[model samples]
Target: MRGARRVPRRRVIQRLVAGMTVGVLTTAIVFAAMGWFPFSALRPREVQVAETARIAALPTTIGFHDPDSYFMNDADVNQTFDKMLATGVKNVRLMMPWAGAEPVQNQFDWTNIDRTVNAAAARNMAVVGIINASPQWAVAPGVPAISGRPASPAQYADFCAKVAARYKGKVSAYEVWNEPNGAQFFAPQPDAPGYTELLKAAYPKIKAADPNTTVIGGVVGSVTDWGTWLVNPVSFVQQMYDSGAKNFMDALSFHPYHYTLKFSDGMAVANSPLDQTVALRRIMIANGDASKKIWATEYGEPMTATDEAGQAAYIADLLTKWQEMPYTGPIMIHTTRDRQTGSTDPENVFGVYRTDWTAKPAQVVMKDAIAAGIPKSPEFQRFSAITDPSYGEVLTPVYRATPTVWAQARTVSTLFETPTGIIASPTAVADKARQFGGIPKTPFQNGYQDFDLPSGMRIWWSPATGAHAVGGGFVQAWVPQLGMALTDEVRDGWSTKVTFEHGYITWMPWVGFQVTMT
Candidate 1:
């Protein structure tokens, strides 16, 4: 009691208060600084999709969402996916409404969701499960229990954890919410902070439940709407990054709906769906989320396209352009069938099929695109856009693969892309590289990747050379011997000549001049 007298309570309290104050100030400063660039660019130019304007030949069985899957009977659900499979759809996106999944606090109901996921799994299709919209019991008194922000982030996280734990391996990915940037989707007002909070909460819960399940942030809508009624798409996303959103999402999602006749336009337009993707990706790159891919989760031209045939054409065009995007994976075309054809709401007409599940002209084009292994116009010429894979090895320069093979493995994140995108089947590349009697390396580096196969060969891809083998016998014998990967591609009268390497390989009308070697 003499030497170690009781500490002064006032001094102890003062120290604690000072520390807390400093911590709060430091956090405030960081958050403020993060918003500097964003606040400055409140109204910026719509990002243009220049080099990224090329289209790809996506597999026919792309992923589609069922707007009413939760309410649909088992028979209807089965028929929907079955019809999808028959038409080449390999994946589906289903919703696990927080309200329905756990109606009474802890009384979780996994029955409907379980059936949806298991049904897809049985069809060998993947499912992208989503969790959002708070329940009435969980939210504040008389809050209307909308499909927007929850009672709190914790409640949303708890719900997500339950969904993740229950579905674990069945669901391929989990999107935080639908369209948080839209007032209609997020409710009250589009609060970017609240959405970020939701992601911050839900991402970890889903990951903790199953690390393999991909966690995507809330899907975003059009970025070029002039930032009037709702949050600016780019700004909303920028705020998300500033608020430490990158740490929370495995991938970014966007819905690039073209409002008017711009549906058939090229990606160069500011409002082009492809342009929207390119712009969003630019934001990702600037915000240090370039490692993450952008999925055009929902995009389509509604049946407002005058005639039913016009709607079909719009679907084909939109799908074609999006499939070409290098930054995208599993590009979904909204829905398989129109949800509200009988209602006055035009939004219900985005489906490729009628409400009765009958195929529209667009649906027919889709099926044909899948069957032909490329996007082909049923009425127009059958264009061989992506290379004919049947030719053992389709040797073409990057320029030759333009419009179809613009981006490949290096810009890739999904297995689907790794197989059919730029490199055009890593399997075939690996097998061929092995035949060359050389140990191959993983496709690494930036943007497009280079593969170092045995026998002094390097898989180099530039805008000029496209993607080709340089310096080795693997490219030497093309026709007679076979199994060779030659940049035998030529465009604009400049077919790839297997001349002894001296400099950059180039062609006109596609990839411009860039660095190369001899």
Candidate 2:
């Protein structure tokens, strides 16, 4: 409804380019030579440099949705931009409300948006604009009178074209609409085909107006219809593709508000934003659109219910995971300042700063991440292969992977504790190290060492035994009935044995593991 503030749905609680100076190009080449780069310099010079910088510039991994920046007083606006810059924010996401700018069919006022865009430009910060809110005149007759959808797709296209034309050089990208999958934002009841029509109409027009501007589509919210308020985001994205939305936009965007769910929960739980994003990627891959990136345009926790420290930790965790995903792009936090300092409403407290402009723990975390250049590294977590049917393959980031021996320390203490540090393994044993996890830890005793796996399994190695995985239900049964293994696995013709602190477990070729408690 037009009556509501453009706050995000109540439920769920949930890149720069240009100015590639010669010096930066030189730096890019130098980094490439040292094996640190967006691309290898194995290609032609012109194409290599441009593509490299463009890749590096992408995903704009650390931006904030500073809607308040559009309405701030001149002094506050300048101050806010300064704060954002000091924290290393590479870009700012602004709300370009269509209704406010185009109230009466083409009669336009760009005062607020102009101020915000100009402020960001003055500081050399890129701007990603959210073009939303349909004016009353644009709503088609008999439409459900929802707040942000226009009557005809062309009406929205016209506005997008106008915006792209007006701020061609200043704005870097535009999101078609915000959360159109939610009845709260779209009209005629959250129809994917309907939203795709808008994207199909607007993409070409916006490109024609400003060819360099990126048009991001599929701005769906992370929600499912509990009743009639929302459409399942994963299914909605597929519907968009079915409606031929694949070629209409440069990239797809979604709001990944976790609400009460933690980032870890998203990794393991079924319908989390992270899980949904994976499903959406699968959909894209199946449609042969695998190269397209999925941007998390809005993500954050409201401090009213989630503690400040908790918000910082979750955001940090989310950023690390985002960096690990090759298909992901920028992850923009919801807002810049609390809408009201002490309001109980979650929307009012999503900001990393209080309304009075004091910093929160989340702001500090953002500052540190930006300063670190948002490095890409594995999260020392249980990894899942995108193609694995049962989660066995170990996936390491191309760069900054944890050292094999040290990485095994996550589950096994002996590896990090033993003085027999970094013993060499035989070629046969080393070849299958990844199957266990990383390199083997030092031999815990005279002739035996262990390799820990991400799946909580361990591989025991000895001159006599060579190497073999010893885990699964057998290990589960062994740990309770017996204690930690006291000796490496010993094999005789047809059986295997491992002595534990209080007992022993014997394995027969056909009979599996049998434990004997002392």
Candidate 3:
């Protein structure tokens, strides 16, 4: 007896039985929750399809920066034109320098111009010839020399009429001026009066020559405080409207360049172009032009040599978001080729293609993005999972679990049971949960437990608490230790029989409950 050791056989048996009970109960509970159990009397109803508005076809136009320069060498111009055609580009915005086209009074040279048109047409790309800048003949003889400001309204109108008549049928659209709000282009005086006069004179001639062609005005440069230059885009638009010039144009064009005062410094904030575009849209809506569409005539992301990838991602996201908006129409990236000067702007790195005719990584990404359609962001994906239940098989309640609480969180996962014999944190349980569909609410805490009930059914613990859970259903949870957060959650129908350890808080308005039967 002294040599024999005593053993707790009953305790060992009890522990084994408890472990077996948890295993069996978990399987039964999962089956019950999934409506697979024979005793399951309730089933989740099918999720409703969300209403999505049909998006209009977005215009794909590439800015042909300094066409005058590109066409300088016939061989180079022909090669570039052929390449553009091969790229599947359907449209080009060609900058037609008023000074260059009409260098001498009433003396017009259409040699290079005809070459450009014929070349583009051969590739089947529609041309949007932008007439900008003033020659010495059109302006005051002794007026200060500037870049794009036209000299006289009458001369500018005459030049526009000639351009319209020459390319009436071939050109798709005509933009009257470029960055008229900027001192660099519309300088001497950046006032809207001069611009309105130019539009009034040019729009009629364009329409008269070719009724099929579209004439657009207001190629206002960036969203700067135009007031500083004695011109506000909103006010300028109003002036144009008041001047009866609004009806003359088919679309309103704007550059919307998010130019940083940093002068190509690497530290400038990105998304400036998008922000300016939104502001322009708001201005248009505020001014009673809701029906009119906006054309981003010259939008771009100027990236530093090292930040090309970031630039590509930014461009992709911007274009995708732009396509989603209702009023947005036609966005033309600034340039097809890098500036010859290797500068960050005008001669800077905004070109999608390198000077050597190689496609920049950004260019490749852009082409891929356009061909692949809008990219789905992670935020959008999570939102969709919460709002679209039929999109996947996982229960919404199980999909929304916090990743820190659940180690099984994957791109997709299904929840089946609660851990009792095997202790799992709340975050671990939530990481395996599916998110509920529809608009997202606040976050809450959830707990899991199990109970053996009558009818061979088991009651599984499913409880939620927190800011999101306060409104009901699955709530997002945050675990600071893991530096992880649960974006969404769903309370599966199986949880109906199980009592919550902690009651959920209701912060949102009460929506009627949906019951399902299988």
Cα RMSDs of all predictions? 19.8, 16.1, 27.7
> What TM-score would you give candidate 1 relative to the actual structure?
0.60
Q: Best candidate per lDDT, number?
A: 2
As a whole number from 0 to 100, the lDDT of residue 112 in candidate 3 is: 52
Candidate 1 or 2, higher TM-score? 2
Q: What clash count does candidate 1 reach? A: 8
**Over the stretch 1-518, how does candidate 1's per-residue lDDT look in tens digits?**
11211111111111111221223234223223322112223232232211111112132336677656655668988888888887777767787776555444555545556667767877877777767655546555434443435768888898889777766677778889877776555655677888899899888888999898788885887644424336557778888888889899988887766545433342324444444555577678777776677776666656654567776676676566554444556667667778766554556676777888888787787677767755533311212244444333211111111233232211222111222333333433432333343233345333122344344565544344344555444233322222222353345464334432343344333654332344
Task: Kindly report which residue stretches of model 3 are placed more than 4 angstroms away from their true locations once superposed.
Answer: 1-71, 145-148, 226-232, 259-275, 341-346, 376-518
Q: TM-scores of the models, in the given order?
A: 0.60, 0.65, 0.58
* lDDT for residue 286 in candidate 2, whole number 0-100: 80
For residues 343-386, what per-residue lDDT tens digits would candidate 2 score against the true structure? 88876788888788899999998998888766544433323212
Question: What is the per-residue lDDT of model 3 for residues 76-193, given as tens digits with 9 covering 90 to 100?
Answer: 6677766565444556767565544544455554545666666666666677777875654455543432243666677788778878777766777888887666555665657676
Residue 341 accuracy (lDDT) in model 2: 71
Of the two candidates 1 and 3, the one with more favorable lDDT, higher being better, is 1
- For model 3 the local lDDT of residue 431 reads 28
